[model samples]
Target chain A: MIKVQNLRKVFRVHKKPPGLSASLKSLFRRDWIEKVAVEGADFTVEEGEIVGLIGANGAGKTTLVKMLSGIIHPSAGEARVLGYNPWEKHDAFRRQISLIMGQKAQLWWDLPGADCFQLLREIYQIPQQQFDHQLNRLTQLLNVGEELNIQIRRLSLGERMKMELIAALLHSPRVVYLDEPTIGLDITTQKAVRDFLLSYRKEESPAMILTSHYMEDIERLCERIIIIREGELIYDGSLRKVIEQYAPYKRLTLHLQNQTLDESSKEIFSKMGEKVQIQSDQVSIQVPRKNVTEVAAELLRKFKIHDLSIDEPEISDTIEILMGGKDLRQE
Target chain B: MFVNLAVQLVVLWALWTAVFAESGKELVGEWDLTGILSYGVMVFLTGRVVRGGDLQMAVASEIYDGSLSRYLLYPLNYGVTKYAQQLGNVFPNILQSIVMAACILPFMGSSSSVDLHVTGLLMCMPSLILAHLLFYIMGLLPQLVAFWADNVWSLSVLMRFITMLLGGATIPLSLFPEWSQGALAILPFRYLFEFPTLVILGKVSVNDWLTGLLTCAVWCVVMSLLVIPVWRRGNLRYTGVGI
Candidate 1:
């Protein structure tokens, strides 16, 4: 369980102009800029609930997670995880939670993952039986059977990430914060990671707060999604509700048996959708959800259909809209 | 430890032989073969006790990798952990220094015209340990600067060099000018090397020993006080960047 109230984090950064002269001048007279990284953000995650924290880059998602995990103290306000003040950093509090970052690793570089796991076992003071059981289960689930004995540096990114997940979860934490857990992984590996997370959540019933740019991960793992923008919470509710609120259009792609349609027929379909682009034998159209059925019926009656598919607008698009079309910052 | 010591002893023998051959004597000043042996032992011990490299590396790496935040979160005191780690290093250092001394003692032989009082030598051991602790603390103060400074390695190395020179690790404090000697005597650096060596050599009076011990005590207290405030301020300034 986690509770956060009016949390804020401001970073003071030195500003300097380019060139040798400016660099020299900065030594004597420097400018300081205060940027609000996380501004008065608030959220609560109940026990055993899997929540997806959705945001574009610089949405303060990681900042909020850091505060909850006790990695950094909040500039203001209060955050409590599992009834313990996170910033206080009590061992008991640490024992109950784990923070896993996809870009950064906790595994020993030159040493094998198994050795690192053993070191963590001692550090966490895990019971021998529990450590062995968890290690076996997690390695099996992540499908990193033989990779455990190999040095971490020799493993691929996906394998290393799996090991990182295992290292973080070896203690069987009650609360887990996963920041972009599936980032940079291939589709199959991403799906495997998602499946593992889902299964782990089900079995352990830990409160998990996940942040990932990939919508598929959220779709598969989280029923609840919280969208943040510019250090503020913009949307907090069900995933379906977020999609319905921001993106009301369905993406329709039609494959036609005839490569070319008459100019007038193309014009008619153009009137039915906002953006229509024809490529090769496929005609792609963005149509409002309400008009999808009617539009498809009209197209079926008018043209020779070969293959057709309908898809909802990506969650990334909804997030971009929520953030006012700002570019997403990559970690 | 033994391996490292044997290597150092070989280097020391080569250095002393060169100095003696060039000078056309067995020694220089009051330093005979025995005194030179003591000097070599002290040098080896000082170098061994200088655990500043590891401490600086640990601090810089933690700060650079953003794992320093992990320290802030834990209930354990950072200062206590540092002290404990330094203490752990001392064991290997002492063992190595003894091995090096043993290797050099054979070369000097029993014919050397010098005597070591067992009681005084025993007393000097604790003094040497305290001196090492003082040096370590002094070294540690600069390491905390890594929280703010970009290049802590060069800064730490510069500081360590200055401390070694001023602390009489390179040469005896007696060889310096009277005013410089007086200044060094009051500073923590002299207490770290010169005073401990003098005590072991039986060259220090009871009053001088007490004064040196008191000076070291005051420095320890002052440095201990200074460290916390600096650390707290530094932690506030830490952005926990690259986490």
Candidate 2:
């Protein structure tokens, strides 16, 4: 449903120092800086797939989404959404695509969501029956049937976001670009949104690219993930593989019944794992994933332990490591 | 806003009355005090229709805050959608103009010169709508500068002032010296403001009506065509950020 090759965008922005003097000086000689927003990005998404785009702020995630949605033209490279060049913005291409932004609303703020949907119905030239059916289905799924009559600005952010989703999907677009759909939503609302997208995928199966920083949003919604950092795609694969590769160590923590630990016990744990820390009543160790079980068994047999736990590194921590220029994959 | 306009009319009525009295002339620039006062009332009425606040900050703010992404994604022309949204503001303002003309036109001038032309009034409707379109595009052209500049408020204000003066909303174009009137007449401003008022007041002959409509229509076509290129180039640089 989507094909992108060497998709690049360079933004030429004026650079100026702050103050009235710099403002006046810029009148004659302004400095220009070219920042590569997306650097030779290459990826494709298939029908019925939800690909999560992961990046910290200013990491070009949104830029990639924008270029694919045809909202902004790329300075270089090519992208075809649903077999049409997205940047060309053909009318048929636009009709088949939808962009739902969590921070910005697609519906008119002063008007009711229902009224905005009516306008969208006309804009897309949807059949009356299809428009009515989709409106009913989406509003019912989002459970915003009652709130549709109220002015959009009067609703809460979560409610407004639900309305935005309905608006974007009113015509059953074939390709969807969702940028930070769960950014400001509450936990319950986020879950609701994620669940809705899951069900929607089951029903419509449109190729989707969801860009978000929320780990849960990515974990619960996207099976495949692409990690972007510094305007480049560093990793793209299954989330489990990412966790297995980037997070190679398992954290073994033990709560001890004894207030003191012997030197021999410390030496034994130090031999088993790196970064072993022995406190008064507890010991925590970062052990290799393959040997975590053996180390834990040894510790349990030797120590008078009150509690024991083993946890793999979090996906967020792994992403942070990648973003900070450490590549555990090399090892 | 209505109250502010009302206050300005009262103050201008007294000021113009004094000006004609002090000058000790029956007509200033070929318009008697009563004619100028009637023109002032028409200015307010036409101003309501042509200068509806709906289009004022909408395009500029969207360009700045990246709210335009909503429009960009939809399968619709942004310019047409913007104009359709402003139509809601126009209908009410048009009704208000009619009500004010009916209630206040007689009081502005009791002279026979305030003659209402039934045919001219009917003919003004299409041209009035054309003027509204022309004004909308002109105002929007400068606001699109926000694609590069941070704010276009100063340009918007400057456009408002220039339109008010040259369109005869602030001062009648007849009052301008004869040499400048030729250039002023060639501009689209007068067709937007004063032409409709002149048509209703029976000051326009059939030939003038045809000329005014043609000028307004031609300007609308030219300016509407101008928006396509400007919007296309501007979209090339649009970052679609901030939202």
Candidate 3:
């Protein structure tokens, strides 16, 4: 369980201009600007709930997680994970929760994942039997049994992420904070990670707060979604509700029998929908949920329809809209 | 520490033997086989006790990686953890220094003046321990600069070089000018190496010993107070960049 009240994190960043002269000037008189990374963000997560913290880049998702996990203190407000003040970092608090950042690894790079796992086992003070059981279960779930013995640096990104998950989960902490857990993984590996989280959630019922740009990760593993923008919480509710609120229009694609729809006909359909676009033999339109049946009937009667399909806007598109058209393109 | 000392000892022996052969059987000063071997022990111990690489690396890394937030979150004192790590590093460095001394011992005979008084040796232990602590803290203070500065490599290098020079790891402080010696005497650097070496060599007066020990204590306190405020303010300004 987690509770956050008006969480705020402000960062003072040094500002310097380019060029040798500016650099030299900065050496004598440095300048700094205060930026709010997370501002008055508030949310609560119940035990056993897997909540996705979604945002565009610079949305303060990681900042929020860091505060909750005791990695960094908040600038103001309060956060408690499992009734423990995170920033206080009591040993008991740390023992009850784990934070895993995908981009930044906790593994010993040159050593085998096994060695890192052993070291963590000692650090977490897990019993030998329990450690073995957890390791076996995690490795099997992540399908990384064969890769554990090899040095972490030798493993692929996906393999390394799998081991990272195992290392973080070995202690079986009740609260898991995962930041971009599935980033950079291939589809299959992403699915594997998703499935592992799903199963782990079902078994342990640990409270999980996952932050990622990948909508598929949220869709597969998180029923609840928290959307933040520019350090403020914009949306917090069911994932489906978030989709409905931001992207209410349903997309309908009608495949025609080699017939090009005229402008007037496209306009006719457009009159019944929000956006209408016609290609060589297909007509794609975004219609409101209430007008879908009417729009479909109109299209069926007006066009030489061969095949038809309807799709709700993707969660990714909904999130993009929620963030006010901020770019989510991964580099 | 043992491995490192062994390597240093082997290198010292080879260098000393080459120097001896080049000198045509004539040894330097009263530092014959015995004094030369004692010098090796002194150098090795000074080098080990003045070790700053680990502390520098740890601080630099935590600053660079933004993992220092992890340390800041803990309830335990950061100073304690830093000292613990420095203590851990001392084991290996001391072991290595001893091995280096052993290698030189075979080439140099035992010295008649190499006497260890029980009280002096006992006092020397705590003094050296305090000196090592002071050196570690002094080395660490520069690393805290990494929080504000982009990179600490130059600063760390400068600190190491100063420690080697002023701490008398490479040259004895006694060889310096009286004014310079007096300045070094009050500084923590001299306490890190020169004080302990003098104590071991039975060259320290009781009053000088007390002054050196008090100087080291004052430095430890001063550095801690100075660095903690800087570290706290730096953390406030910390962006946790590149996360």
- Per-residue lDDT tens digits of candidate 1, residues A143-245? 8989999999999999999999999899999999999999999999999999999899889999999999888888899989887787777777888776776
What is the TM-score, restricted to chain A, for candidate 1?
0.88
Tens digit of lDDT per residue, candidate 2, span B60-144? 8998888998788888888988898788778888887787778776666465455566886798787778888889999889999
Could you estimate the TM-score for every candidate?
A: 0.84, 0.92, 0.83
Off by over 4 Å in 1: A252-260, A279-282, A289-311, A324-331, B1-37, B50-53, B70-76, B79-95, B109-125, B180-183, B195-218
Q: What clash count goes with each model?
A: 0, 0, 8
What does candidate 1 score on TM? 0.84
Question: Across the candidates, what are chain A's individual TM-scores?
Answer: 0.88, 0.91, 0.92
Selected candidate, larger lDDT, 1 vs 2: 2
Off by over 4 Å in 2: A253-260, A275-284, A289-311, A327-331, B112-114
lDDT digits (tens) for residues B33-98 of candidate 1: 557656656655655664422465676667767867655543367777666767876777667666
Leading candidate by lDDT: 2
- What are the per-residue Cα lDDT tens digits for candidate 2 across A1-331? 9999999988888899999999999999999998888899999999999999988788898899999999899988988898899878889999999998887777889999989899889999999999999999998899999998999999999999999999889899999999999879999999999999999999999999999889888888888998888788888899888888878698998999854777887898889899998777778899989998888898888878899999888888777777667654356
Off by over 4 Å in 3: A257-264, A274-281, A304-310, A325-331, B1-41, B69-95, B106-130, B175-186, B202-233
iRMS per model in Å:
2.8, 1.8, 3.3
Query: For residue A283, what is the lDDT in candidate 3?
Result: 76
